[model samples]
Target: MTRDANRPLRICMISYRSNPHCGGQGVYVRNLARALTDLGHHVEVVAGPPDPLLDSAAKLTMLDCLDLYNAENPFRTPTVRELKNPINLLEWLSISTMGYPEPETFGYRAYSHLKNRVHEFDIIHDNQSLSYGLWALSRLVPTVATIHHPITRDRQIAVRSVRSFWKKVKHLRWYSFIGMQKRVVRRLPKFITVSEFSKTDIHAEFDVPAERFHVVPNGINTELFYPLPHIEREPNRLIVTNSADQPLKGLYYLLQAVHAISKQREIRLTVIGTPKEGGGIEKLVKKLDLGHIIDFTGRVSNEEFREHYAKASIAVVPSVYEGFGLPVGEAMASGIPVISTTGGALPEVAGDAAMMVPPENPEALAEAICELLDNPEKAKELGEAGYKRVQEQFTWKNAAEQTVAAYREAIRDHRKI
Candidate 1:
């Protein structure tokens, strides 16, 4: 088909926080916007807090909200000098006492600026902010939202894992924003989710009709995550990546499994994220007496991360819940066999290419690891299959094409109203 002579579509992608070091949403916004720009669309990412690592082709509009959630000092108190402004004080107090993540509050600030200049874009694509501001935007412009998955699942799993009833209460309080999210999602005209698993789960959890949801799988940056042909994998070496000390990640089970595996086999586990000096995960490592065999790499650059993936014999994703499992796909893209639990969409992401285990089951995880280690040929076959699967199904180009089509659909739907 020939290109349309009309000017390219202008798209504004919004995310409250897009720090690449922290989580998946940053990577989603960064890559999707770049891919859309490559497809001859004008893309601008309006974000709060840490900046997104965006391509030069895509413009970035930073909406500063004090960035209290940066990983370096996630909840550090602002100085009195910094909080002389009443609004800053309110933001700090609201987040500290109420436990609501600051993104929604920040989104309101971003939306205020964006609404005055809304004419610059043909569509507004929100990366799961689900704030009241987003609801307002739907009233003014062609708007669509990507609800990665229901946050309610995370709260449920986290609460279940906590032994203390008070801790569970705290978890519930922290995730109180879920009520707001469900309300916003139920009323939204169009919603985008990364996988069919997430699509169904969101519909069931948020009580939204399935027809209103659009399935758009996330893409992988194959160039950065490709296999290292020259690096030979060391035996009994494993890798897992997650934000440090997050209970929902199910790293505790993986740690237990690694300890069990080490009792029989000489094994080493490399955690791609840092653990606090005396945090729960670190304490667990010490208590289990497996500190000698486990290592935390803190934060590494993209190149170093790929090298870590290359050197590992296997990649384990033991998350209890994931809206989409990027590490599983990235490891697969790196031609490493994955041992992932059937947490949320992990089975959907891994499919038949990688081994699957039930979540929070160290015995099952250990058994799968032993099977892979004992049969190197099987592991190698799985790795190759995974690489092929990722190449065939997950790529930025595919995601971009589908996203553009979704944008068009959203625009057409908006026109009808």
Candidate 2:
């Protein structure tokens, strides 16, 4: 059956595991589902453990899977009953061997669940879960996969960050799912991605032609991220949203810059993520005597996060690479002056509104933050520019419209075949 362009489409969004606090993927699933439903689409998110939080407009169907990597229990063993299933056995073995088995297992579960209900939805949209099961589903339903960016690039960077031979082996093993992803990617015809940079990077890394990618940028939550003009912005308070120990986040360089600045002036840094105990960030903080000047808020509520940004003088996106820089857009939407590294798609998101710093350069970050702090007028100007840019360019409504167009196209193509 062909889709009616004028009518709302039924969409099944598949996310293997979505934890709002864990990363941007969860945020993407939650917000996009809400946006799509608001557009009058029948949206159902079929997700795994740490299931995403969604708007009341969208229906959520939670798929049970052994959540071995839950923060409370990392690599915990499953019960014999849970392991009775072949899929669960694979998950257990993969995690025991240091491989992330969620994607593969999630695919099996999602496919089994959705396979019988294929005719119930107009299309199946896979969110970065490029598994063989998705390929199987595509043969039955019009499948569109959004590869945020090639996981191979992430694996390469992760391996490069480690030095030990055994540790390198561990990194390689952990990211072994990339091999499965590559094969699954080749089989899908329709694709959606967040940015132009991601479209090109994903094509190059995954060898999927750029022509197949529909570039629908992710939107910033304007309601949650807008500037609070009533609140006085702190001159010495700098904030960054980063997963402290991740090598790709470039937090080490930011910490270095913070340490250097603290020596000359009484500046404080608020990290939105926790530093692993005795990890790289914690060690550097103690070594630089910056423990007194720094604070990690760990996981914060939306209200607290907005309040944190409202109190900051500068918001930094120190990531070395991003599929789409959520922090850049969020900071801009919050009306904060942003200093971002020209890594991956960051420049695409920041545009000319942000001070572009070279990735991994602490000196440049330090100088830029200091310059903005010293000239409040310049910082204010940039903040206003960023906010205006986001209003004009990045909104969830626009993204949802584009996504629906892509879905319609996929349905049309499926009918042709």
Instruction: Work out the TM-score per prediction.
Output: 0.95, 0.97
Candidate 2 per-residue lDDT, tens place, 311-397, comes to: 999999888889999899999999999999998899988998999999889999999989989998888888999999999999999
Off by over 4 Å in 1: 1-7, 72-76, 79-89
User: What's the C-alpha lDDT at position 183 in model 2?
Assistant: 93
The residue-by-residue lDDT of candidate 1 on 1-417, one tens digit each, is 335424578999899877777578988998888889888899988888787878649999887565677667877889888688555676788678757756567667767878888898899999988988888888888998998888888888878877998988888888987877888887789888999999989989999999887798999989779998899888899999874677788899998998888888799988997887787898999899987998789889889998999899999999988899888999999999999999889988899999999998999999999999999999999999999999999998999888887888888899899
Q: Candidate 2 overall Cα lDDT vs. reference?
A: 0.89
TM-score (C-alpha) between model 2 and the true structure: 0.97
Cα shift from native, residue 66, model 2 (Å): 0.9
Error of 1 at 310 (Å): 1.4
Q: Single out the weakest 10-residue window by summed lDDT for candidate 1.
A: 1-10
Q: How close is candidate 1 to the true structure, as a TM-score?
A: 0.95
